[model samples]
Target: MTYFRSMLPMTSEEMVFEAVRKCLDDAGLDAGDVDAVVCGSAPDAFDGYHHKGLVAVEPSGAFAKPFSRVFVGGGTGVGVTISGWWHIASGLFDKVLVVAWEKMSHPYPHAQPLFRSIFEPILEQPLGPNLIWIFALEMRRYMERHRLDKELIARVAVKNKANAMDHPYAQLGAKITVDDVLKSPVLVWPVHRLDISPTSDGAVALLFASEHEAKKITDTPVWVDGVGACLDSQYWTNRDLSYPYYVYLAAQQAYKMAGITNPLKEIDVFEPYDPFTYKELHHLDALLGKPGLAPQLLKEGQLERDGDHPTSPSGGLLGVGNPIAAAGLMKVAELYWQLSGRAGKRQVPNAYVGVAQAWGDLMQVGQVVVCRA
Candidate 1:
């Protein structure tokens, strides 16, 4: 994976090549060994290009091979891996290369304006709504429903950013205080600047192999135990913003497939997407199969790297950076590293099972992947 940053001095193809090359090199395999490829990216406008799949083919090592692109807003990262899982799971491919990249830096001024296109043109676009304003509404509802204090939510940013201090690819790692988060500029009520992750440019790649080939690739192959995805009502107004039922449904589907009835105890590590401070808590609660339970766990420091049931030890999108799809794929990569004992300084002790989740598309889509050592 490439380092998460605001402006990478490389083209989109260069970024993809670096990540896919590193992944293939690590796996000790060549592009010829891969039977198929999947490219995960979001919005052509963000990169100022169309037919992004075609642009990604060569750099992703998909020349003359089965290749496809996936876009599920922020969920594209994990979505691509899921796509690869099925490629091998369905007995259609032996080895699959999954690549996720985003270049938000190419857009002039800022990439935030591009999100305006995501909303319903006739209904929502007239209001000129952006992610921040909509997220503010969700944050407010979550806080009120849980009766959570701003300080509690601020601790997420504090914990994730501090955890990122050990991550080499992290962009915003720092030892900050809750007061620092509270003092930052508030773009919308209940949503501080520090609470939001930065727009970034980066890429991440992963290789999926069948059990037969995986055993040959590496004895310590991290198994993709379970995968699940769900999309809620597209109109954000139709659902209860206080909680994410879509995430819960997706987690349930994954947990059942993984034979995990008790997530808090069975899952050792978690890497839920955290584009915003509250989102980590929001998704965590849903992933745990217990709504409104994450706050207590957070207060007790269970979400810390050294704590029981450690979460986002990779610093998550909040600290590591949010390159849209790449950030989500980064979570899955973090799970592979953690479960395989390759996470180095950020390793969670005794971690055998881990869950990585990402939410996208009008706060409606939820994608989850579970891995085990």
Candidate 2:
């Protein structure tokens, strides 16, 4: 799950095919049973390919089948699930192969310049912006608004990486302290070098099926109860960073569709995208339909692997390694195993309902999926 020197030798397409093959083998299905193929990849710039989907399809088992690729910045992981839902929901297909992979190692070490290149040349490019720079500004804003200490904010990184020690597929899993985070050099004021998820090369695959086919495929099937996605304006400077408005709206849409009035009590586990430590808190506040709950809850040990609400129980991107497109899908897969009581060492108790969320595009897009066992 983590990136290493050996992984860089393989191409992105090869990674996709290998993961998909494993998926097929585990599910007792073959390529012929696949009604369609859905490719989940990050931006073209990351892989250094213009048409990554078409480039990845033949090796991805979509040689002559109905094929489509979904990319929504970092949310492409969960976006793959949302895209595959349509094929099954529309009654046009019984099975869909959803594959998510990212080769972030291509532009390793200093990906900031590549990140800066994606901004609008006329407006934002003039500022020499990178995601870390922008994230630090938001982090400072959130801290100032809450009048909180930096030590409290740094707890997220410590907790996630520590929890990753139990994750079999973790990259940076280890026992670290809050002091370690404080001693880390400040990359941009509030953001520390250790507080960010490392860029990784990884892939994940999931098979989606209609209700009828799901029953026949496996005795235990995790159902997609609700799904919601929202895109907000690109006015990053104009809006307040204290909360993510679009993320809240997306969670609301999902909760409403799932017919659950109370999320904290109803949903047993949560896996929110956390490319940055502060991002875990930002997304949690929005997902919970409130502000400033994450820090306080975290201090009380409520966000732990055995707490009332377990956030990022699978170590998330912070610990398990962030291969963007594959990260969110890995969360969904974790929820499936958790709810089924098959997560092995990291399983939560009685996790019947769960939610996994992803954010992308200059903090403008929110994608959510509510699942049940």
Candidate 3:
């Protein structure tokens, strides 16, 4: 694994092209076989580029293909994935290439200011708030409401970074204990620097084929069982930050589509967004339909890679790295790998139904996809 910050002068164009090329090669297809391309990217502010879709063409090798872009902040990756599914599921194309990328390091000073800018200028911006403040507020809210101790939350940080130890592409795997996380400097009250994932420059791509084509391509194709995305009203003030209401709504839609009545029993694994330590628990509580469930699950070791309710077996954004849109795709890709039994060391036992999710945009949006193998 490499330091994410020390990487990526390669530009997203090259990243997109290479990732798509790898996807095609793995699928045993050529560029000519791709009927269309769907791209997902973060704000042009992160990569410092305008017209991201058009700019990505040359390197994406979609020159003569129908090229399109879907921008959904951090949810861009899975967002484009659902879009590509539409292309094929709509019977408009047999194969659609889905790609997502982010170069957060391109922003001067850091992506932190860019994250702050996501706040409404009139109401929130004038307060001179940094992103950590909101996270702290959310963390404090979740903690105060549940009387959750810091050590219990620190376990997520320890577990996820340990899980990343097995991911070949991971950036922040360590053997730290809960005490270590507790000892790390606090960036904000109840929000330690160790609790946060590093902003990175990365890209990921996948090929979505029509069911008919997928059947012919591989005997062990991972089926897209369901997908759901939702957004909440702006401002954390509008809703309770402890529970991700939008995340629950999106997961419910996905579970219904997948015919899952009991998520804990029906779903084999979880890959929720984890840009922060508390977020993993925050999103899971909503996803599980029980508030304060995540802390118990984490303490019971149910979230370990080989545990009963495995979560973030790919190290999640915290361990593997967070490149905005690319991070979401990584979660989706991790599901594919776990389902197909291609995940090397991080693979779970007899994994079948799993969910991948990403949450961002005013801290209100949630994107989810269910996969079965």
Candidate 2 Cα outliers beyond 4 Å, as residue runs: 1-7
Instruction: Provide C-alpha RMSD values for all models, in order.
Output: 0.8, 1.7, 1.6
List lDDT for all candidates, in order: 0.93, 0.84, 0.85
Candidate 2 weakest lDDT stretch, 10 residues:
1-10
Candidate 1: regions farther than 4 A off: none
lDDT of 2 by residue, 155-193 (tens): 888878977778876888878888998899988888898
| RMSD (Cα, Å) of model 3 | 1.6
| lDDT measured at residue 320 in model 2 versus the true structure, 0 to 100 | 86
The whole-model C-alpha lDDT of candidate 3 against the native structure comes to 0.85
- What are the per-residue Cα lDDT tens digits for candidate 1 across 1-373? 9999999999999999999999999999998899999998988999998887677899988999999999898999999989999999999899999999999999999998988988889988999887689999899999999999999999999999999999999999999999999999988988999999999999999999999999999988999999999999988899989888999999999999999999998999999999999999999999987879998899999899999979899999999999999999999999999999999999999989999999898889999999999
Question: What's each prediction's TM-score?
Answer: 0.99, 0.96, 0.97
Cα lDDT of model 2 overall? 0.84
Cα-based lDDT at residue 258, candidate 1: 97
Better of 2 and 3 by lDDT: 3
Name every residue pair that clashes in candidate 1. Answer: none
